[model samples]
Target: MKPILLDVPLQLETDRLFLRAPLQAGDGDVVYEAIRDSINELKQWLSLFQTIPTVEETEIILRNAHIDFLKRESFRYLIFHKDTNEFIGTASLHAINWKVSKCEIGYWINTQFSGKGYMTEAVRELINLGFQQLRFRRIGIRCESTNLSSRSIAEKLGFKLEGTLRNDDLSADGSKLTDICIYSIIM
Candidate 1:
């Protein structure tokens, strides 16, 4: 099996977005605001939902992610609107299984910025990075079945639906089992 983590800096840009490596410790404020502003929207999908971070806590979060990036176990990116360079969302490829040439992608965009095709563009660009640059055979995205918009993005990106995991998520207020619709693209 080949090692997935490389010393090379990974960066991808679409016509409308700047998709680069995750932020460093100095970028805590920006990350905090991005998460805080979109907390309400993110809570709907993520299992480990939390209240908005304060400036201090945000610094800690950035430091941790930065360290993870250095370790090469997970890769997280901050989505930036190209025209305005505005922070839009966060995306990550986690649990990378280099031996199998696979990884799980996770993302969340601000509610206010939803439905403008920003995420779709980001995902497509990221998929290319995974398949072409990283030598990945398949990339998977799992989202709550109720998240219609996310599912639509997966479909738009040419991922084949691989069925659902019944009641696989427990978070927020209830223990409702979320049907995780797995979508994959084999390169």
Candidate 2:
């Protein structure tokens, strides 16, 4: 079979944010520190976040991400503050099931930036990328039910709440089980 050409060199800009490919060498550290410093504030909502990774590990991770990007198997973007040029978060279109023409959106923002509508704006741009450029048939988001902000963003963006997976996932702190709210936008 021929290789799938799924790369898109798209840099999206919102009023206060810049969404671009996660290509820098230390981009993971940029993301790790942003979330590490606010672990307490974010643990409740961001489940994939673990303890702060050392700079070395983050560098390796970032390098690997870039390699994966070239292979067209995954696409991850670092969300940066346009004014400050600071790495603020990460959003990914991964688990791409091409046979179905669908992908899942995963995102996390720094706690300080929460409640500011930044992620919502960023996610909308991601959806546009999926639909317009990637030509995906559907895009989906999954978040913890208790995460009101994520749920609100999904709902506001016209994602239908497909169902709730009871105790489907673990919280970031690993002390509690959380329900996964699956939301999807069908194109």
Local distance difference test scores for all models = 0.78, 0.80
Residue 80 miss distance in model 2 (angstroms): 1.2
**Model 2 TM-score, all chains together:** 0.89
Kindly list the per-residue Cα lDDT of model 2 for residues 103-173, writing each as its tens digit.
98888788788888888888998898889988889999998888887889899889999999999988867
- Please state the error at residue 39 of candidate 1 in Å: 1.6
Deviating ranges (above 4 Å) for candidate 1: 1-7, 172-174
For candidate 2, the 10 contiguous residues with the lowest summed lDDT are 1-10
In model 2, how large is the Cα lDDT of residue 42? 70
Find the candidate with the highest TM-score and give its number: 1
Q: What lDDT would candidate 2 get against the real structure?
A: 0.80
